[model samples]
Target: MFEIERRLYDEGHRFVACIDEVGRGCLFGDVVACAIILPQRYTIDGVRDSKKLSPSKREKLNGYILHDSIAVGLGRITPAVIDRVNIKEATRLAMKQALDNLTDKDGKRIIPSYVLIDAERIQTDIPQLGVIDGDNIVHGISAASIVAKVFRDSLCISWDKAYSGYDIAGNKGYGTAKHIQALLEIGPAELHRKSFISKIMEGKK
Candidate 1:
């Protein structure tokens, strides 16, 4: 898992940031991105892709990753912006925002010497590499995945309270049967991505 980082280190790059995003396919809520810089030679046991981990495990590792990271930053792009720009472009923008927001324990900004992203490249002047399935094989990207997942899941919980009936808490804004049924009955909440749900809305009519 550290092999990629090791290679970068050998290439004379320190302070490498690994990034990943969550909630891209959701029908509701913002897309969230995370960027994390880990110390050289750092490795956390049991860290892998967030999708493969149980929610409890992810929550536990989220804390550990944050505690051990050199710097951590998060970015969120709203549903409106996502609708205007499309999910792919919104995801890239969120990644850029995450890198821009990177800050140390003392709240000082930290610019990474290099960036490693999961399957997508953002517009950045910093040296970057986008690895296919990076969150599964790269240590730092895996850690960032956990952080982004936990954070976005927490937002879903809060949104469930604010906007009921779609079961946002349970489905996490996915197009589950219950969520689709609720959309047919109560219509979409303000947070729902209109671009994503146009078909469902048409079906309702």
Candidate 2:
């Protein structure tokens, strides 16, 4: 269903990277993009979108991908930029940055001949295919998704320490009952997306 598979182009059995991203839906924190290329022999069972898997499973795969995959690169777009340019464009920029950092399995900095990218069209001059369910359909993309999610989750947990009252640790920077309640009680912090929660507390003001 994608050019990555349509061509069957073998770039001499190096690494065919599949790229994916997460955290775009979060009202707080940065949007993260991760790109990973795995060797042909490398395989992980039951890999799918990070959202579908348990937190434990995602962490396990993080280890697997780190040890087995080729170059794994993470890119983050900050909250300030997301506020200024919007999430869609920020996500695009992050994804592009992640892809631009890909390297071959042989440890050389080179573009993959074919790429399977989840959702967004990777802004690169390389031959790539954007698959709607790429993370579920492709193993490499699933790896990237797990890597990005784990990294972002850890970052959110860390932020919870510095920025109290947001419940970012429990909510992982997402809008949840605890998170919304915190906002109602104490209001938003610098990291919180002001536009997202203003409606919930509109009547209070």
Candidate 3:
């Protein structure tokens, strides 16, 4: 997964921040994005896409990545903002925020020379490449995915306390059979994406 990043590094891209998002498909909660730049030649064994790892494995990798990364930043757009702007734009906004957060107090720190995104492009002056399924093929993007997934999942788990019975922790706000059934029975929670829920309700009616 490091091949493309290594090549880009060899080509003089000094700091390559790999970016990825999670919870875009969730029926509730926020869409989260993470930007991460690993030190050159730094890697952990068994680092893979967040989807391919167990929850425990992802949690472990998330900590390792945080501890080892040169710079790391996270962004999230809530369900309300997501409904107003739509998922695509909300995702882009989140990604941009993630990139913007990769700065210091004076805004002169940890900026990337290049950005490798996962299947999406953002409006940034920084040179960026949108790689299809980048989280699976690029080590940096894979690390970003792991971090984002863990962060978003923790949010869902916390939200479960307030919005119980939907199994937000287990389903992580996805439209699982149990989640959809809960929606039908209890109506949408505040965290539920109204745009997505309205369409499903319309279909059922």
- Point to the candidate with the largest TM-score: 1
The digit string of per-residue lDDT tens for model 3 on 77-175 reads: 999999999999999999999998875334455889999999999999999999998999999999999999999989988999999989999999999
lDDT of each: 0.95, 0.79, 0.91
Cα lDDT for residue 125, candidate 1:
94
> Which candidate leads the pack in lDDT?
1
Give the TM-score comparing model 1 with the true structure, all chains together. Answer: 0.99
Clashes of 3: 0
Q: Candidate 3 local accuracy as lDDT? A: 0.91
Report the lDDT of model 2 for residue 92.
82
Model 2 agreement with the true structure over 124-190: per-residue lDDT tens digits: 7777778888887777888899999999999998999999888888888888888888888887788
Model 3: how far residue 124 lies from native, Å: 0.6
**C-alpha TM-scores of all predictions:** 0.99, 0.88, 0.94
Worst lDDT 10-window in candidate 3 = 101-110
Q: Judged by lDDT relative to the true structure, which candidate is superior, 1 or 2?
A: 1
